[model samples]
Target chain A: MDKESYIFNKFKNSLNGDDGAVVGKCVYSKDLFVEGVHFRREWMSLTQIATKSMLVNISDAIAMNAVPKYALLGVSLPKDISVGEIDELTNGFLKIAREYGVQIIGGDTISDEKIVISITIISKTKNPIYRKGASNGDLLAFTGNLGDVKKEFEILENGGKISNDSKFYIPNLKDKFFYKVAKFINAAMDISDGLSKDLSRLLKVNSLGFKPLLKLSKDELCSGEEYEILFAFKPKFKDKILKIACKTNTKITIFGQCVELDENTKFINKCKEHHF
Target chain B: MDKESYIFNKFKNSLNGDDGAVVGKCVYSKDLFVEGVHFRREWMSLTQIATKSMLVNISDAIAMNAVPKYALLGVSLPKDISVGEIDELTNGFLKIAREYGVQIIGGDTISDEKIVISITIISKTKNPIYRKGASNGDLLAFTGNLGDVKKEFEILENGGKISNDSKFYIPNLKDKFFYKVAKFINAAMDISDGLSKDLSRLLKVNSLGFKPLLKLSKDELCSGEEYEILFAFKPKFKDKILKIACKTNTKITIFGQCVELDENTKFINKCKEHHF
Candidate 1:
């Protein structure tokens, strides 16, 4: 086993091995957004950085079909950060929090060389979707489009101007649509570390394999930080799920189906791992 | 108002303004321990650093009369951190977590310049004690002793020899005794930013004042990072609280009484403000 799996297996009985930890009726999730690793200071304003940090964590809770409620923020600021910039960051946090009805209750801050924002979101859910419940014939689906983020990333990398309204910085999550179809879904996970990587994680837990039916580019399959929901359901519920997606104004695409593990099934394992 | 208060007040209605956020029967708390701010790399081993990070966050939950159940860790490691060091850190986390019965659920890790460990502990308590319930004539008390931590800190800072079993690295918490007195306590908070500063926070919320009778030294009242529980109760429950403390093999010190605000009563605001 790798280092993370070895460590996680030590306490596997108590852990849910899902996007968030299920404790009673509440689900707790945490995410870290480092300055140079996740985004550069020159790429966006501090306000945008703060907003994105909150959204990424909120998305994790949403992926579990949970109602986002409370958030605890941990921030490490550089020496050159100004008071006005701190205000901007606070406003950014408050703005997104207010939109989601999540209260920023408590947090800790300290001095560091660069900005490190860590957010932990607590939400409520009765029936949480786990990544280990997919059956052999369950259909795999994903919300929103893929591969577009890589286009924006390339423009930013080449010192080119991308649109200010790019979805890369601010992802439009379809949380309500997920809630509408929560009971029908068998398994789900957020596509933060790309579809191929996250799908491998979801399938490995159940000793299953996948065969893609739709054509997808390499960028769509391997690019990270999509923040979209990838889920599975029985083929019989396809029409109901599609009806709900239409009613909630969400775009979902069926891409693959879970199958029994065999030598002929090709598994993609070349995706990026966020933490080394 | 200061920056932190101004920011907190904006969401004060939705917050409890306590050591942790109260959601249903669970209390969630988050804290950040950054290298060079909380501890120096040369002063301790990676195990000590990792253990201290978990303990400090657990201390907050204990102060609220909560039984710690789950923990989510967010770690930012430097590039030079080896796999063996990661194992050491995980062992440290597992060791302390086992002692508190807090299961390591899920977390995210990333690479950064310095080692930043942010821990979020979720604990349960049916009746959580807040810092705004102290009334006039209520007795103020504290667990364990103070002023000794400064001596140990001085020894460490001066490059002198100190015992490896120092309380500066690991605190002995009396969580059971606190739960026994949870119903009787009126107000409480952990003495993290020093007794004087934290006491000021506890009383300011209720428009109350405190006059210490123990004749504590400046170091006792002003030293930060002393994770002792400071609490208040009616004078009528003092005997019962002392009885429980004695039965639990814990020490209790009654040092003051809550009084009405007046010019004769002095307030000490000299304690450290961690995030300015």
Candidate 2:
């Protein structure tokens, strides 16, 4: 047998130990955080860098609506970096892992010209909410509002201070209320790549789209990392979602609705123009 | 209360899906393959790149004694690359996933300066083999012979010609096994930066070291990319392990024992020391 086939066969057999306990099929995901490309070290702290690195997957796992269990991370850094720096990053990582109840079990470390972080998060759910599960009549909604991150980016880009102006960058306090809202979500993914791009991805995956009642500006369109979930659900749950959001003092927004497509198509903003 | 603690806790709880079922406690690992830095695009085919990238973790998972399950992969490529070339790498990754029963459920992609593939693999096992598990009294045994990969590197470094015409680099065959041997070991790891450097990591993690029963030379000490498992077990299992290797048709090398100390207690090789 070929190498891949041989490996999978062994992996399959290995799952069945002598005992009755059997591990389930895990839906796995991996991502990279590169210096300058994925993030800038100066803009964020070692703690923020580590948190964002971990959070990237936390957002992804939430997107799938699959309960995440573990994270394996690998990092390559320059020789000059002190062991103290690495320890700080690990503290950040372990803090995140312990919070999510996921363990930082194992990983690899090597030397390279730049800092590169690779994170793998594994989660399993009996009924994993996939991008394919969106229905034609589903209403599209977002857990939080946008424009703030765009505004924050603008402030930082054009000498605006985020911390000094609180109620601006992250406006709403969506704590426990937002968690409750997540349960009712049919399909969810963060608006990591502004509304225009991620909206395209979320729709393309489901093969559905809608006419946006509202159009976002260029800044809103390309805001790189919003880190808020955009979900699609039946319109009936709208009120319940709002009520839950209200309970936790978080904001909720209804961006648009999941509409029927004549052909096997992708979700686009132009509703009447649902051309395959 | 601290920043790291806050992010991890929220992220963790979100991953568990408090409303219902949860996936918990997983092992996820990631490695970055940089062209030229990590691998030369000119030297390796896309398929080999893909396979090697995946194999790095396969060996790692094997070292940890975990059944590899999921992968979070990121490929930052040059914009000039063709879709077909990208597909070749993707197919290579998918092929390995199918083979290892690893689910490439999700990850990220971007355009960058060079082709940077940061892969994170997730795995689980009730008993994870850790570098810290080995004790001073344990006998250090290794599966598969070293010096083979060093031979390949030597060939490349010296105009791709081996001094010994008898040397080889074929995928399979008893005389030259270049692939990894990661199975049934107490605590294991791949030899990426030669035995001298990599062994130091295993020894450091556990605050342990070993001595040599048989004498060795410089050739045997600093062997690189020997992607085999260096494990320590009770001497009583030595004969049984030899039989196991025979049954598996794998090679075994009793490189040395886990010693007490040396010039550097982290790792002590009775073999020749490389002094600049």
Candidate 3:
């Protein structure tokens, strides 16, 4: 197992393996975006960095069909950070919070050698969708294009610049489509850690596997940081989902269907792990 | 102003300066404990590090008169971290959660060069006490002894050893006393950044100053990471607070009273700032 999975499995019994933990009507989720580890300072501006940090966290709440209500940010900044940089970082967070109608509650700030941010998003969901609800014969689909993020990531790593509109800079979360189709979907999650890896998790929770309907390359299958919605539903709801997708202006890709687990249940992830 | 305060001041209109943010009946708080910034690995075990991180976050909730119900931990581990060390780290978090009847909901973990933890505690409060309610002539008091944590911190900095039971290792939180006296106290906070610095915040919010009733040295006044309760209450409830303190087996020292601000409203914080 990967180190992140190993560490997460240790607390499996005490915590849920869903996109976010549900307590009553509240869904709590946290994500960390650290300097050097998650992104290079040269690759993106502080506003882009901070904006992605909040968006990725908000994506978790949206995946759970929750409306993010508030956010608490934990930022570890560098010692020589300037006032302009601080303004940019705070403005980045404020802009996203305003767009999502999320209250910037409270958090802690400390000094470190790099800029590290850990954000907690508290969302509300009257009808929450967990990752464990997929069943046999359920149609599985993902939103938007995938392989593009991996291409962007490689370009940035090689001293090449990508467009400001790259998903690496700002993830296009499918909150509107997800919320409208939440009641129709059985299981769902945001594809932050690529399709294969994240889909493996969705399958594992239901003790099921997938039968791919469309052929996808390793580049597409293992593209991480694509904040697209991966979801499953009864095959009968496919038409309804497609209708909502058009209404919400979302591009839905019907990639696979849930099936009984096989001997090859393990999904190979060739993408470089972002954490370690 | 310090960089931390300056950054926070920019968001003053949006976020609360309270120990935790109150959203309806829920209180949310986040705190970061980074390696080198918060402690050296040589000075603390992984268990001690994890334990202290959890306790400090809990202090925020308790200071707001809230009971922590769920915690989301964001841990950044070194690349060479071992399986055994992961167990020790998780065990530390589990132990505290069990003690407080808190659920370890969900969190994100990543790889870095050193251990960095940012924890978000979601607490519940029927009636939360804020830092803006202190009135003129209200008495201010702190729990337990002060200055000991600073002495221990200096000892560790100089390669000197201290007892394991030092307050630096395990802060004796006044949750029991604070909860019982929640209705009586006008304002409250935990003194993580020294008595003088934290007291200045409480007074500033209430538009008040303080008159010291007892003599205190710079060491006692400027000791940081003490994690003791600093609170204000009306003089009429002094006896009641004392009675609750005795019943709860807490040490209460009434050392100051709130008064009108003077030219000396600017309190001197000679203690080294924890965050730049």
Could you say which candidate leads in DockQ? 3
The global C-alpha lDDT for each of the candidates, from Candidate 1 onward, is 0.85, 0.59, 0.89
Best-matching candidate per TM-score: 3
What lDDT tens digits, residue by residue, belong to model 2 across residues A90-182? 787877777777765445556666777877676655544555556777877665666666666566667645673232322232324544665
Quality of candidate 1's docking, in CAPRI categories? medium
Chain A TM-score of prediction number 2: 0.76
Q: Name the runs in model 2 displaced over 4 angstroms.
A: A1-27, A66-69, A82-102, A123-127, A154-175, A209-222, A263-276, B1-27, B98-101, B124-127, B132-137, B158-185, B200-209, B258-276
Docking class of 3: medium
What is the C-alpha DockQ of each candidate? 0.62, 0.24, 0.76
Cα deviation in Å at residue A239, candidate 3? Answer: 1.0
- Model 1: per-residue Cα lDDT over B5-81, one tens digit each: 65556456656578888877888889999888788887778888988899889989989988899999888787677
Q: What is the RMSD of candidate 1?
A: 2.0
The residue pairs found clashing in candidate 3 are none
lDDT, model 1, position B115? 83
Q: Where in model 1 is the C-alpha error above 4 Å?
A: A1-3, A272-274, B1-3, B271-275
TM-score of structure candidate 2: 0.76
Tell me model 3's lDDT, rounded to 2 decimals: 0.89
Task: Give lDDT tens digits, candidate 3, residues A1-276.
Answer: 588888788777535788899989999999999898889999999999989999999999999999999888889998899989999999999999999998887888888899999999999999999998999999989998888999999999899999998889999999989999998999999998899888988988888977889998888788998999899999998899999999999999998888888876444456665557
- Model 2, backbone clash pairs (residues 3+ apart or across chains), number: 17
